[model samples]
Target: MDGTFDREHHLIAAAHHLAKALESTTDLNHDTKWLLSDLSAHLSRAIELGKAHRAHNSSTAEIEARLMSAAQTITRLHSNHPKIWDAGHTTISEYLKAVAEVQRLTLSLEDMDLPKTSRELLDRAQNTLHSAMARLEDELAHALIRSKQGFLEHTEYEDSLVSNEDDSVRTGRFSSSESDVGYETDLVHPDSIPHIKSIAGLMFGSGYGREFCWVFTGFWRNVLAEHVAATLGFEQLSIEDVLRMEWELMNSRIRKWRAAVRGIIGTHLVAMKRLFDLVLGKYGDPITSSACLVEASRAPVMRLLNFGLAVSIGPHRPEWLFCLLDMYETLTGLQPEIDALFPDETGPSIRADFHDLLMRLGDSAMAIYRELENHISLCSSTTPLASGGVHPITKYVMNYVTFFVDYGETLERLFRAQDAGPGPNIPDHLRSLTSALEANLNWKSNLYNDRPLKHVFMMNNIHYMVRKVRESPVEQQFGDEWVKAHIGKFRHHATCYERETWGPVLDLLRDDRRVGKSGQKGMCRAFAAAFEGVYKRQTRWWVPDLQLREELKIKATKMVIHAYRDFLGRAGSSVCEKHVKYSEHELGTYILDLLEGSPKSI
Candidate 1:
């Protein structure tokens, strides 16, 4: 066939050359010109025959028949039954081969007019290719859906967020090796990737790239939403929902949201991006893969972010401050992962949204923290505690401030970021808050009518505050000096309480030269009455700290017992037994029973 075609091409060229020579020669006769014209017409006919021969051949007929058969197979598999996956490997292979052949024919016949039969065959090939592509599209989606790894378990996410005490935020950088390991566990199954790539390549090459991307992105988007909502237990929360949610419930959800953010951005979205690249990278269009990934992940990512945003913009209550800090820290921790996952055309917008949420949370947290001073200063009790024990406000403020100790570093960062100039740090703010609480406590102590009870109230509250600061991380914030200083303040209050309540009682035991026999009896009665009254009144005053209570009891007992014994030695011979209402041993016992927080009478 090659030799015959070459011979025909040579004959035509030779005849054309001879005719051109005959026409150019002026000496040539009319007969020669007539012969040249006939030769030209024959050459044109031969050229037409050559074009027809090239356009239609034995191989072309066979290819058309194969395409028709392949189209029939595809139509049968997809039309009524739609069991493309049930087809044998040979059937699939033949269908793919037929599509390849159609591509070749289309390329070869480009820009050339085709005969009716050839055109019809090409048209049938196109229809068959479309059916095959449609089936492949379904297969791609099915494979993706079937092979997708399950959502990262909520426990797994929670565990990831749990870090050492030093690493309160768990901002550990993800190593490539670690990410690859995680991706392997969460991405599309290895076996499904090649099949996906094959389908994606064919569809993209066949002018169905947009359709392929649409299916991929749409499926993953819905899958992501389902996994977030149903599997991971994160729902889209509007600002109103967040604002109205009770703290206990909102707190639980915030924890879940933190975990979900880590799981989705750190694990799931990363896996999705890897799967997209693996399936579509074969076509070597990174933009399409990235765009698809962004499209698939944006809604779910924003859904998670919207929850954070809602929480951030909600009321900055002190109770919600820690949870807000938790949210801020969670996003701060996941920033690296977010940057890596969304580094594309749309990355900036997503990153900006995330950053905005972080800022809002930080701002909210700082607002709550800064308001602590006002909260403490405003916390007051019109009715003093009758027992003079630790005040309710004292417990609340101390515990609240102590909680900030754990988030000291986070608070420092937030404060520094929010600060435009030099301002109070965490310690300063906490100290100020403590000062406000102490001032409020002073005002509350005045509510007590008895002077001694006022001292007891201050002693109890100040001592409790000092102990809390010493025992908790709040100590680190306030320092040893602050603890010592507060310790001194409580001790001072204890001294004043002893002086005011027991000083006059001790004075009654002083020996007097002017005491006659009746004077001795009267003095004894006065001392006994004062002792009983003081003991009975103080027993009602509560010393919540066991060590402090024991110390105060021992001191008071020693002071009263020493004085009473001395006075008894000096006046025992003068006073009557009835006038000495109590013995030294009994008197000491009564003194030791004071400050037990239960009222008693002798």
Candidate 2:
């Protein structure tokens, strides 16, 4: 049966039709510009709505295809108009590829019963998309550097300007048609400077006052904000907060950039004028390039710095800048370093395997939280951080863990769906996700720090308890039924780890306490250091040195090892939160005993 066009696909087809129509017509009519822009917007809404609906792979593929087709049309226009080359190019081939990469990796693919041919066909689809994007970037980058007329014959753009660019504005490099505009081709803000060039396209020699605001309001603002939220592991943020932080930075960036361009034009008019036209002559009008997509985060980073750095960049700005530079270098450089993580599927990276595990443990905890978060506060009214209160972040952390675990499960489900063929199965997908939870839990217990999981358990318990009291007081307001059952599930889950993983460690800490050993303080310091990290607190380091951080790290490592050694001797299979209760008598007494220098060994 033919795959029928869904709502999103229909929208995409309409958008592409509009793009094709505009791409072919050189006269540039308001109806076409407005129509194409509206379609672009409709495509955006379709993508957004589709994501909200968990649209099928075909749906996404269709949208990407339409966008790519639009990209191709715009690429042709680049020869005639150079500024569109930057903005349109990134939106299409390069940036879309990265977005597709994320979307593709999320599918579950294990246990699929697909015929070999079907499997190969799926892989070929991915390869085709990836290869086309790669080719497009290389082609556009070279095309950008070449000298050209109204456009190189093969190049194109639908004039992705707010108002249409006049073809006369682009005279051949050989003739002195219009005064050469001077500008910096610094690649400093490649993502942004293109729109400013659109303004130069005006028939009256007037530019769009802020053409970039179109991209900002319409595209990168949403993408970057989404990226920030995903990276930071936030599920929800207040609209006010987002506007104050994310939107403010974006607006600030535009303000700075416009003013900078105006300043450059005023101070170095001849150079700026020539540089502007030179850019137009070479790059043409197109959307997307690997080079540009790689630099997608740069404009945002610079924007972040312009707003954030002013607060503290004065003292050691160079070091911070080096960090930023290093980040870019690693992301672009290491992207090609890994092939796959697991041996059988040959998908995911070694790091992805680890991320999967973390996700699993994170989710299991959150599943329990969903049932228990509100009512836990009733059992104890105390928060995590208030002198002895907990943090709200623990809830998010657990949920984020759930998300990662779900990512793993989603991958597994993909394999299953592949095997089943025809209909995609979701329940199988969820199972694939939770499979990583147990393994991830074990991995953390065996972290390089080598401390006992009891230490972590204690920290989590404290944080979880705190989160209940402070943020989720709703349970306190209601009678607890499902909450108790929820806590029961966590207790049952905890029993699964009742083995000697942290038992020896717990015993060691207990013995050190019994004889009044001095290791307790050192241990707490190390644990504090791990939880808070070096940035916030004057904490111990995992590995320290007198060169400052190195010395501190060494001391911290010793302290942690000492604590671990003591705990290892005493930790046992009986180790559970039920057996463990911390109060002034049990925990404080032990620490006090250790300080008195009783028996040293656990």
Candidate 3:
């Protein structure tokens, strides 16, 4: 038997040497070269098969010895330097090669009906593979932990990624470009990925794929949790926590939650999916990679989504509406990415939860929007603003609706879906809201005892509403026609103001033929009393808008000044200088001072 083996080995060695010689030869015809090349290839292949067959037929004792040696090498290498699989370590290749050989021998033994000695050798090989996989799992965890990129500090994240606007405007501007969101750095060190993949492949091939997934997914779950908490300042909150938490604190956390969602979905999870593909795609199949990615990312992402869900289901306070809208807009914007990243069995559930959350938020936002109109309609004031300036509810509602301008397109889509009436639109909603506010203002204006001051109050508020719409993007939603219509409303209020306040004073100056020459002085006295009274009272009234204040002043002057000049000319011949109080120019000057917001007593 020994002699036969020796002759076979010698024959294979001679064939390999001759094949090498023939491969290097060049001086031959085309047919001769082709025949020689084919013979050389066949001879090389036969030599490889002979060597493999000889190894396979070798003694079980020799195979056992080889397995023991490899096992010892793996154990010694791992024991000596536990982190040999770390990114920069050079010894990891040697360790991995030994484990790979153990896996090969163990897999080869599985197909054979081994004798007692060969079975023992197979058991040793399997044990070595198991130990190697266990060590590799530790190495994978360590490599992931050591190579993870540091999270951005909260302040730095806010400065770089979050907007500085107030919550309402911040939410309104939820649309983000790909470049605007996400981390620029890799999640794990690029150099470490190959080692991770190598470890993963070996473990997967050795039937430790489930264990490998556990290590990978568990480590990443913690990493993402840390990033969400440490960097983005988001924490998992139960529905009760959301409901019971103070709105001030809750609002702050909601903002942080938004930042967390953007960072995780847009940057960290994207990097994580790529890393999963890099590490596990080749060895564990696409399904396994996708499953691991979903497992790792689901908890962290759900932590964010759950908060939004809580807010969506919570009380529909008017103050919370914008944040809700912001959350809704953010999720709506990220739906495509969410769907793409999680495409496994859990993906449908996640997508369903995500869609359900969006629907709830939209429903909540619509409820709050409707609540705003109701609040405005029901709003009442027992005491009027003595200055006849803008009402508190007017400022609140207009400023509230003005923030919606930034969310105009988003709100338009939402309103269209939520509005059940035929042809329901954003402009109509805005117009309805403004009408509620107007009705509220009209009711509140009755609190004023002076009728003309009521007109002043209406004029001031209507002008303010128009100015707010004109100054914001809401003008587009409301359209120029709506703005023009409101402009006409305020101007009509202005006309009524002039008629009520100044018209009586001007009527007092009309030439009366019924007045005898002796009675002209008494008429002059009455004019002085009426003019001074109008000046003292109306000067004390306020118009906060500069443009409207000046316009009212100009028109008042034109009406009163011309009327007084004519009255003085007709009554000057009979009246004494004492009754003629002052010149027409002084009256015009004083009229200009009316509606300056500051009260001046004459």
- lDDT scores in order: 0.75, 0.33, 0.76
Which lDDT tens digits does candidate 3 get at residues 304-345? 778888888888877777778888877887787788788756
Alpha carbon deviation, residue 462, candidate 2 (Å): 12
Q: Give the winner by lDDT.
A: 3
RMSD (CA, Å), each prediction: 6.2, 34.1, 11.6
- Candidates ranked by lDDT: 3, 1, 2
In the range 1-602, model 1's lDDT, one tens digit per residue, is 76799788788878877777777787878998888888877887887787778656655677677666656655665665454444655655665665665555555554445667567666766766776677777777777777777765633333223211221333222233233323434566776666677677777778788889899899999998887786437557789988899866786687677666766776778778878777776564557687788889888888888888888888876667767777787788778778777775757778889888888888888888778688778876688888998887787677666676668678768867887444347788788888998999999988989998999999998998888787776788898899889989999999999899889988876764467667778888898888888878888878978899999888888888888778777775647465788987897788777888889999
* Pairs with steric clashes in candidate 3: none
- TM-score-wise, the better of 2 and 3 is 3
The best candidate in terms of TM-score? 1
Candidate 3 RMSD to the real structure? 11.6
Q: Estimate each model's TM-score.
A: 0.78, 0.17, 0.75
Local distance difference test, candidate 2? 0.33
- On lDDT, who's better, 1 or 3? 3
Which residue pairs collide, candidate 1? none
